[model samples]
Target: MLRNMLTRDELIQWMRTELPRLLQEDPAFRAQVIGILSEALVSKGELTRLLDELRAMREESQRRFEAADRRFEAIVEELRAMRADFERRFEEVDRRFEAADRRFEAIVEEMRAMRADFERRFEEVDRRFEAVDRRFEAADRRFEAIVEELRTLRSDFEQWVRFSQQEFAALRVRVAEMGIGLGSLGLRMGQGLEEVIRQVIESFSGAGPLKAARLVLIDEAGELYQPGARVEIDALVTDGRRFLVEVKNYAKTDEVWAFHRKARFAEAKLGETFEKVLIAPAATASAVALAKQLGIICYTFRAAESRETSE
Candidate 1:
């Protein structure tokens, strides 16, 4: 019973080592042991049952292992495919990054060009402003020069006006002095003529069959006389109509004929005939002859008579 109840490893060892020994011991013993072993086999049928169960478990395990192996192979193939996809995506990302870099470089170059253009425009504007400032300065200088010239011209004009006024005043004074001198000379000549005529009339007053003698002088063409000259006789006298004396002061021999003619014209104007006498300090021979032919009396004080009268 103990032998039959052996543990599984022990029972497998007994079957391997002791089963042959029991058979070599006797034939009849072997047959009897075989019969007993058949009984023991009946009793130990748990081993066969265990073996069948093991076989069933092994087949199930093998099917499970093969299925697991196929699943692992499928998982490995998927991982390889995922690696290939990742490599392709990485290349595409690199290409995108390179394009973005080129665009960024282009933008930087455009900015640099804009900055250069702005600098050039600023310089041009500065130059134009400087030129405008210079023109303004020149205009200011010209205005100042014009003002200075106008001031000088005004000063000169004022001086010239003053000089002209002074000169005009001096000329007016000179003209007035000349007029006064001429007036004085004319007055002196008139006075001298009056004195001589008065002396002659006094000398002749007592002589001559002339009882209350008359004196007359006439001036014709009086307009021809010089300014301030006396052409009219200073004295005129008249008695009863028997005789008429015409007296003239002669400064030139050429004037004697003119005087004689004027005296004769007066006789015709008097409307009554009368004896005529001419009196003068000097007369031409023709004047004397003409007087005689007309039966006109003439008189002059000789040097001897003049001296005798003075003594």
Candidate 2:
């Protein structure tokens, strides 16, 4: 019964140790155990039944083991397929990694080439800039030379200006001396001309227009002459009415207007209308016009030319 309860390895161990001890403990035990087993043995029919049950159990267990073995083989085949799929995917991943590494290497190489090209171009630009700097230095030297020439020219111009100023001052002094002499001569000539005109007026006596002709200096008052103004008349004559003549060396329009004002003042003072005349060496066109507008006769006398009258 204990052997039946034990596993195959446990049953072999118990028999190896315990069977010899039991035989030594009882000499007749073995025969008695055989006689009891013989007495307790099943009949032939019972033994045949037991053998059939055992065969049936053995067949069942074999069938079960075969089913388990088939299941294990199927599981092993599935695992093998999974492992092959994993290896194929891993190989694809390795190829992808290699391709990416190649692409990265290409990019790095391209960048290195670009950097080297840029460095070379920068060196060329630096050389160009150096050449430009050399040209600027040459231009600066030329500019300095031009500046020096301008400074020399300015100095000469300043000296010329100073000499011209000195020469102008000397000429101005001579001109002033000549002006004084001319003034004295003009005064003498004017006095002489006045005397001559007085003689002419005197000779004109017993004439038609100049029957009572005489030269007189008038004192009068107007814009050009205040009260008691000393005014020189070139001739005081009677044409049908009184006449006042003005004598000038050179007559301009302003002198004509001034003489008209004096005539006005004289007319006011004497309480009589008088004809006005201007005598000169030469009169400007504007002076002749003004004299005509003012009803003043203008006469020009030159030794080399004919005596002209403003009609």
User: lDDT of all predictions, in order shown?
Assistant: 0.59, 0.71
The superposed Cα distance between candidate 1 and the true structure at residue 168, in angstroms, equals 45
Model 1 stretches with alpha carbons more than 4 Å out? 1-44, 123-311
45-114 per-residue lDDT for model 2 (tens digits): 8899999999999999999999999999999999999999999999999999999999999999999999
* Maximum-TM-score candidate: 2
How do all models score by TM-score?
A: 0.28, 0.31
How many angstroms is residue 138 displaced in model 2 relative to the true structure, after the best TM-score fit?
99
Q: Tally clashing residue pairs in candidate 2.
A: 0
Q: How many backbone clashes are present in model 1? A: 0
